[model samples]
Each structure stands twice: as structure tokens, then as C-alpha cells.
Target chain A: MRLLHAVWTDMRFQWKHGFYLVYVLVTIIYLIILSFLPNDILSVGLPLVVFSDPSVLGLFFVGGIIMLEKMQGVLSVLVVSPLRTIEYILSKVVSLAFVSVLAAFAITGFSSYGSVSWLLLFLSTVLTSGIFTLCGIMITAGCNTVNQYIIKTVPYMLLFVLPCFSLTGFPYSDLFTVIPSVAALRLMLGAYMGIPLYEAISLVIYLTGMNYLFMRWAIRVFENKIIYQN
Target chain B: MLQIIHLKNDLRQILRDPIMAILMVVPLLLIIAFKLMVLYLVPFIQALIEFDILPYLYYVFVFVVIMCASMLGIVTGFMMIDDRDGKISELMSVTPLGRNGYLINRLLFSSVLSVFYSILGYYVLNVVELPFVTILFVSLLSSNYSIIIGLLIFTFADDKVKGLAFAKAINSLTLFAFTDLLALKWLTVLSWFFPPYWITLVVQTPHTLLVYGLALLVNFGWLFLLIRHYRKK
Candidate 1:
């Protein structure tokens, strides 16, 4: 309860900074511009090529914030505060995740053309990406220096973010629900194609479960040892 | 007792800082990432449909504006942290070196870096629509905005490491946003209000010398303010 309160306050602090709000507003304006393109290209191709996947944008943006704290030793300072590792990670997950989801929803909702089930797709995106973001936290947690973290993460981002566009076009098998972003992509494509919702729901369950377990392991890592140890 | 030599040495110490690497990577990141994207995407689309060169030109304008303006805002934020963390200003204040000397070196380095990044960005667009000599001036103005923003941020850096990290974050955000490419065809209304935003407009139309002129005025205006602030410090 206390940690949740602290997380809420932390979000308030971030909101007061006004940067996130402005960035989202900017993204909204960006999507509105996309709304004007010709239907043929706009519907099929424009979103993929021009907008690409907005999901990646959220992860990269939040990852940059996490990476900054690591770089500036802000995490180190915060670690000594009256909070547990779970508390800290949860704060980021709760605060940054909501804004990121909001950004993704706004972009996809405004631009994408598909069934009314797009809302479900957006929710699946938010949940599915939880694992990836957790993976980001776990992967980035133990780095020695800020530059080292960036070097490590950029390639991973290129690996994930680049291929994501192709996935929307390609048809990976049902087993793809196991791969994190793939599950999210499946949900989006399903919604766009108006495929059945059962698979989407099932994939969402797997994503949510994986995200749950990942957080458990991540907590252990935090409790057992110092992260960002050089 | 940290002298000019120490300042030079400090510069050498964290050259490979993540923030610095991000700063260095950013121009390349925006240009190359978007260009490769276009390269792959254009072929994919064209296979299914016909095309006009306007799409390609639109991309050029998009990237140029997005990269230029973002470079302006983010570099400002990063330099702020750099100057603050390194105890650089205080150390410099104690030395016989003029504030102008320290600031001038920053300008030189940042300008060179900005230009290098801009050239890479320009080349990426060249495969589509390389702006004329006039657009080159616009690129230069965008680069100058970066250098000036660095100076502005330098005066505001809370500390050196913070500066370094802020540099990386700001640079990353700006690159991801890529202001110029946001939306095209009717984009002039929104972007042209900002000076760096005109880089693409000038590149596309070449008639908006006034936009480039205003960008210069804004940059010089900031430069003057930065110098005045440094003197007070």
C-alpha cells in the first residue's frame, strides 16, 4: 500500500515536469497528420512504413529514461531511500507504462483501420509489452556504466524494433505467442484482419503470465545483489 | 587549481561517455534508420502500387526538419548537465582562461560535430532529393542551432555526469521524434513557426530565405544571452 502510494507520488512528480505530456501531445499531432494520407496507401502501407509500430516507440522512450538514471547514478541515490527494489521497479512499471500505453493507444486508435476490436488489441499491446519492458529492466539492471548500457541496448532495440514491422506483414505460427512482441503483433494483425479474438486472449494470458514471473525473478535479482555494479 | 590543461584533460576523460556516444550516434541514427526504412518500405509499397517522387521528397523534408529541430532542443538540455556535473565552470572560473575561451572551444567542437551529423543526414536525403546550395545553408543553420543549444545548456549544466547523461537522453528523444518527417504535404503550417523547422521547408521550396534568416537571428540571440550569463557567473 505504501509503495503504491509512493509510486503514485513519483508519477505526480514526473507529470509536473511537463515533458511527458508535451511529448504525447506532440505524438497526437503527429498522428493527426497521418490521418490525412490517401486511403489505399494510408490503410495498407502508410502505417507500417511511415508510422511503423508505435509500440517500439514507448519502450525506447521509457528505456531512455531508465538508462538516464543509470547513467546519472540517480538509481543509486534512490536505492538508499525508504523503498524496496520491488517498490522501485513497480513505480517505473506503473508510471512509465501507463503513459507509454496511452501513447500507443492514441497512435494506433487514431491511425489504424480495422474492426472495433482494436481496443482489445491496444490492451493486448500494453500487457504484451510488459514482458519486453521487464526484459529491458532485467537486461539493463546490472550494467556497469551508462555508455556500456546504451551500447548493449541499442543493438537489442534494432533487433526487436526493426523486425517488428515485418511481422505485421508476415504470418508467424500460433507458437509466436511465446515470443513477446510477436504476441502483441499477432493481436494487432488479428484485430486489423478481424480474426477471432480467442487466440488474442490466449496470447494475452501467456504474456501476462510471463510478465508476472519475470517480475518475480527481477525482484530476487534486486534483493540478492546490487545492480549497476561496476 | 584545475587549469586549461585540466579542462583539456577532462574533455579527454569521458569522450566515450554514453551521452557523448549517443550524441555522436544520433545524426547517423536518424538519417540511416529512416533511410533504410524508406529504402525497404518504398520497394515494398511500389511493388503493389504506383508512386510519385513527392513521397521521396516529402521524406527528405520530413527527416531534415525532424532531425534539425530536435538536434536544437536536445543538445541544449544535454550541455546543461555537462557543464553542471564536471565542476567545469567553477574550475574554469579559477583559471586565467577567459570564459570565452572555454565557450569557444565548446562551440567549435559542437559545430564540427553538428555539421558532420548534418552532412550524413543530407547524404541520406540526396538519394532522393538533395537540396540545392540554398538548402545547404539551411542545413548549416540547423547545425548552428545545435551548437548554440549546446552553449546554452553548458551555462545551465548542473554537473558534469548529469550533463553527459542528459546529453544522451535529450539526443535520443530528439532522434526518435525526428521533427521534420512528422507529417508532410500540409506540414508547413505547424513546423514553420519554429526556426529549425524551416530547414526542410527551405530545402524543399528554397524561397524561405526569411526562415533561415530568422533561425540565424534566434541562434545569435541565444549566443548573446549565453555569453552574458557566463560573465555573471
Candidate 2:
């Protein structure tokens, strides 16, 4: 519950940020455009955006958040807090994951066919966002400067984003079952969905476990590494 | 001659810079990955070759090509901006390495490196069935266009952060439209104005030498203009 408070606090801080709002607005305009697209166009647009969009926004904000905190000397304070490294990271995870899922859900509510399972759609987006946000934390936490972060993140970001475009390009909707982000999107489409409850639960657990491992790694790196010289 | 001196100096600095070391590795990584990914494409290509979905493949290739080029642009663009505010450019201004040499070296160095980076993307996939002439043409097109574009941004990017922002914005705007079919046809309509729009057409050809030559001329012409302005500035 305290972690929930911390998450809300961080989210409030993000919402009040002028640039954050501007970015959200830019994203909103893009979403609005997608809403108006024809079905054929939407088929590709939905999957591509779903696949790539998280990291686009996620990595930027994660880098900004970490960099800003370091610049302001808040990172040092966090290091000394009663919050364990896991807890400190949880604050970031809870906050960013909640916000990202909410945004995806809001967009889904308005733009997508929504004939799919709303609960499943929400669950899957959160699942992908959880892992992706953790990745953002890892990269942003490691790099001292924005330039290094951009360089390190850009190639992986491209790798992560481009292949999922193949999902829509290819016919086997089951492909999503193998790919994390695409699986989440499959749950989003709310159709052609096949998977036993046991299978779904196991997949979700595997993904969530990966996020936990990455978060711990990021926090450990944060705790031990002196991130900057100046 | 002063420019060659700064070129040497900048080259030394770039060699020492972590970012430069990184730029050297990126092409290699993409080449490896693209090669693996290309294995999958063989089957897809066989199916799609008969369809107008060539446009879609064209879109994907163009996206990948621009991604390669823009990565180069972002690197060269930021480093140039950083050098400008640092004592380096100001020092060159006073040295026998006159501003002309500095600008010329920037042009030559930037274009050459950008081309190298773009080829790495194809190397990973070993997507080299096209003629060597065609590959060179495409590399020049991708790299030179980015180099020219970077030169234009270098003129206005007053700081490192702004330079990075320009890099991201250019990459995003280009990649975004191709991936998102929502604005799909709208973007195709718009891509007519951009250089990457032609890359797909150039690469898909079995005897695309003439097409590549045309692209090289168009890109080199732009490069020439940007280089000229870079001098006057």
C-alpha cells in the first residue's frame, strides 16, 4: 500500500511535468488518427503501434526520470532509503506500469474494436508494459548521460519494435503466443484467441518473473555503480 | 589543409570517444541479426513476389534503411554540435586549419561514416543478392541523404540535447509513418517527398544499376548543396 502511494506520487509528478503532458498529447493525436483509419489500415496500425509504442514512450521517460533525479541529486537519497533496491524499483515499476497500462486501456476503449475481452486486453497490455518499463529502467539506470542512453537503447528499440510488425504481416495469430508484446496484443484484439487458462497463467507468470529479475538487476546496478563522474 | 589537420584531430577525438566505438559495433550487430532475419524472409518473399504487397515489403525495407541511416545521422549530428560549442571548432577557426577545411572535413567524414553504418544493416542479413553496384548505390543514397540531412541540422542545433532531439524526431517521423498503416496511404502520399521513399524501388530490382545511379545522382546533388552551404556558414 505504501508502494501504491509512492507510485501515485511519482505519477502525479509525471502528470504535472509540462513536457510529459505535451508528449501524451502528441500520442493522443496519433491515437485519434488511428481511430479514424480504415479496417485494412487499422489491422497493420494496431499491431505495429501496440508492438513498438511502449518502448518509444517508455524509454524516453525512464531516461528522463532517472537523469533528472540524478541531476537533482535525488538518486543518492533513494540509495540510502529504508526502501530495499527491490522496493525502490517497485516504486518505478508500479508507477510507470500503472500509467502505461492505463494509457493503453484508454486508447483501447476508444479506438480499437473492443470486441475482445476487455479484462484480457487490459491484463495483456499491463503484462507487456511491465516488462518493457523494467527494460527502460535497466537502460536508463545504467547510463550516466542521455547520449549514451540513446545510443544503447536505439538499436535494441528498433530490434524490439520491427519484428512484431511481422505479426500483422503474417497470418498465424498464434505467433503472438511466442512473442511477449504480440501476445499482449492478441489479448487486446479480443478475437481468434486460443489458449488454455493454464497456459495463459504460465505465460503471464514467466513474463512477470522476467520483469522481477530485470528490476532486481537494475536496482542492484543502481545501488552499487556510481552512475556519474560529475 | 587546415581542415585535414582538424580532420585528424577530430578523428583522434572520435576514436577516443565511447560513442565512436559504439558506432563501429552497431553495423556489425545489425548485419548479424539481419542475416538471421533474412532466413525468414526467403519464404515470405516467394509468396509475396507475385502480389502488389511489394509496396508493403518496400515500406518495411525503407523503414530499415532509414533506421540505419538515421542512426548514423544522430551520431554524426550530435558530435558535430558538441564540437562546435567546445573549443575545437573555435580553435580551428583561429588555426591554420581554416573554417573551410573544418567544414569540408565534416562533409567528407560525415558522409563516409554514415554510408559505412548503413551497409552494416544489410551485412547482418547478407541481403546482398543485388549487384555490388546496386548495393553501393543504395549505401550512398542512404548515407549521403542522412549526411546531408545531418549537415542541415548541424547548422541549427545549438546544443547537444537539441541535436539529439533532432535525431530522434527525424527517425521517429520517418519510421512512424511506414510502420503505422493507420496513416498508411496518407504517409505513402507524403513519402514521395523523401529520399528513403526510393530505396525499396532501388533494392528490389535484379538489374537496378541504372536506378541506383539515378538515386546516387539525386543524393549527391543534395549532398553538394548542403556541403556548399556548410562552407558559406
Candidate 3:
């Protein structure tokens, strides 16, 4: 119940701060660009757009949320509350993942309405957003200001974003599947192009495991940096 | 004397955080990365796909310029938000550094850094053969654009969270330069409203006095409007 309330409050907070509006504007822009593309090009471009923008939206938004809470001293209050650190982290991941899912669906639907594998797309967006949100939480944990968080976020984003080059047939690209973002992109691509069911299932399982590990890491970092002040 | 102290404090603040130091070097790194991509990757892709991308290569330089300027603007904008949150802005408004002084210190800081970075980015990119005066004029105008960005974020966002979102929106305005590349005549006109668009305009036509005048007018016009709104807030 408390976790639900936290998620609700976060949604409200994000809405009040115009995150949803930003997403809407960004989605419109994506749709407009996608509309202009020929089908042959969009067959490849749609997944890339979904993977880059909506799927990683959490990575961009979570820093602002965490920095705001930190600056406002909300974390200090929540620390003393009965809210477990894990629950706080879960609220953020879930609320942000909710937004990312909506955006991914909207963009995918608009670009290739009937052809997409909805199931694979949903799982990919959710898991990818969760992974990036955790990464955002981990990076923002030690930072005091938004500027610090923004700067620190670059290398981490590069860590994830760079691996996607493997999708472009960069040499030795198969090795990139070890990274969760690469897995997520592969799954997203699976939604566009039919992958073997077993491969799809395995990627889903792999991403879920990655999410759990990232969540654990996020919790540890939050507890240490924000809660314990270490 | 007091301004020097402010400058020192700003320097110390940036130095205290290793991330800021990295940010200082990021533009140079970006320039090198862009140069590398243009030099190696573009040709490699051309060879592989048999497509020519040479005609659109100028967009890379524009991206570097806007990116360098925007990063500085974001840094200074967040600094202002931090000051607002810490109540430092309020205190400074009453001190020897009045509100304008407080605002000037930050905007000037970002603008100056932007000038340095823009000039450096131009030399580092070094593909298009621009005259020295043109580079200086464009860099000066970019500093003005950076000031407008800083002031916009500081004025519109009451808190850091909002500031971050607002900063993202402001940075997206750089896309107008890409929009200018589009052949749609109406759309290109719309791009003129954006300050960074003028940077692209001036660059594309380096000898155009009208573009230089309009770029200055538009950038400073936005700066003036934003300053008024900021002071009102």
C-alpha cells in the first residue's frame, strides 16, 4: 500500500513538473519524423528510435527526480519513515518505467501499427527502462546537484549506448550481448523482425536477471549514499 | 575586487567537483570524436554503402558548436538553480552583489566559457575554412546564445527538477539548426526565431552582414526578454 502511494505521488510529481508534457512533445516529434521515412528505412529506424528515446527516457528523467528530492530534503524525511530503501527505489523505477512504456508503445504503434510484436515490445521497454532507471539512481546517489548528476550520467550512458553499435554490424558485435542494453535492443529488434521464440525467451530472462541485479545495486547505493550518508 | 572573488569562488566550486573538470574537457573530446567520425567512419560507411554524405558534413560542425555552448549553459543554469534552492540568490540580492550582479556573474561566466569553448571547438573541428574574424563573431554570438539559454532555464524553472526538464527543452532548440538544413522554405523561416539557427545562418553565409546583424539582434533580444522575466520573478 505504501509503495503504491509512493508511485502515485511520484507520478503526480512528475506530472506537475511537466515530464509527461515533455514526453508528449518528444513523442510527437518522433512520430512526425517517423512519418516522413519510407517503409524500407523505417523497418530499421523504428526500433532504433524506440530503443534510443523512450526506452532510455528513464535514464534522463530519474536524475532530475532524485536531485530534486535530495535538494528538497525529501530523502532525509523518507529515511526515517517506515519506507524501506528498496521500496523507494522501486517506486521510482516503476513510475518512470510506466512513462517509458507508454511512450514506447505510442511511438511503435504510430510507426508500424499492426506489424509489431506487442508482447516483445512491452517486455523490452519495461526491462530496458528499469535497467536504465536503476543506472540513473546509482549515478545520482553520490551527486549533490543536478549539474553533477548530469555530468556523471554521460559516461554511464556511453557505457550503455555505445554497446548498441553492435546492432549496426560493428566488428565483434556479438560480444556486446553481455551488456543489458544490447540485450534490450535485440529484444526490441525482435519485435520488429521475428526472432526465434527460444531466443526471445532467453533474452527476456537475461534482461529480467539484469534488472534484479541493477535493482540490488541501486538499493545498495541509495542506502549508502543517501541514507547512511557514507 | 569583489568580482574577482566571485570568479575565484566559481573556479573553486568547479574544481571541487571532478565531474566539472571533466566537463571542461568534454567539448574538446567531442570535437575530436566528431573529427574522427568524419575522417574515418563517414568514409568507411561510404565505401560500404556506396552513399555520399559529404554534402551534409557541415551539420557536424554546427552540432559541435551548439553542443559546446549548450553544455556550458546547462552548467551555469544549474548553478543558478542551486543558488536559488540554497537561498543564496536571495542573500546575494541583498549583498554587495545585487541581484543583477548575481545574475551577471553567472551569465557572464557561462558566456565567457562558451566563447572560449566555441573558439576552441572551431579550431579543433577545423574542416570548413572560416576566416578568423568570422569565427570570433560567431563565437561571440554563441556566447550570447549561451547567455539566453542560461537565463531561460534560470527564469522559467523554479526548482532544480523543473530546471532539468526545462534545460532539456532549451537544448532541443538546437535542433532548429538541423531543421534549417531541410529544404522546406517555410520551416527554414521558422528556424530563424531560434538563436542557434542564426549561428547556422551566419556560418552558411559567412559574408552576410544582414545575417550577422539579425543574429545579434535575435540573441540579445531573447536575452533582454529573459532578463526582464528573471528579475520579475
Q: Each candidate: RMSD to true structure?
A: 5.3, 7.0, 2.1
Candidate 2 deviant stretches above 4 angstroms: A1-48, A55-57, A68-99, A102-114, A140-147, A150-213, A227-230, B13-19, B28-40, B45-64, B80-108, B116-141, B148-168, B175-189, B198-233
lDDT of candidate 1 at residue A14, scale 0 to 100: 52
The 10 consecutive residues of candidate 3 chain A with the worst lDDT sum are A106-115
**Ranked candidates (TM-score, high to low):** 3, 1, 2
lDDT, each prediction: 0.56, 0.61, 0.84
Estimate, for each residue in B32-130, the C-alpha lDDT of model 3 and write its tens digit.
899889888888988977667777676778788888888888878888888888899999999898899888888888788778878887777676767
TM-score of chain A of each: 0.73, 0.79, 0.96
lDDT of 3 by residue, A1-230 (tens): 99999999999998998888877877876776677777878988898988888888788878888888886789889978998888899999999888888988888876754488889989999999999999999988878878788888888988888888888786788889989999999999999887999999999999999999999989998888878888
Q: Flag the better candidate by DockQ, 1 or 3.
A: 3
DockQ of each: 0.21, 0.16, 0.64
TM-scores vs. true structure, each candidate: 0.74, 0.63, 0.94
lDDT of 1 by residue, B142-191 (tens): 66666655654455544433334344334433323235455454554544
| Residue-by-residue lDDT tens digits, candidate 2, A110-224 | 6764354555555666667766766677776667555577787876666665555655655765565555555555444442144467756666676667666767777666666
How would you class the docking of model 3? medium
Q: Give the DockQ (C-alpha) for candidate 1.
A: 0.21
For A27-109, candidate 1 gives per-residue lDDT tens digits of 65656656666665555442342223334433433444565665567768877777777777777666656665666566666
Q: What is the TM-score of chain B alone in each candidate?
A: 0.65, 0.73, 0.94
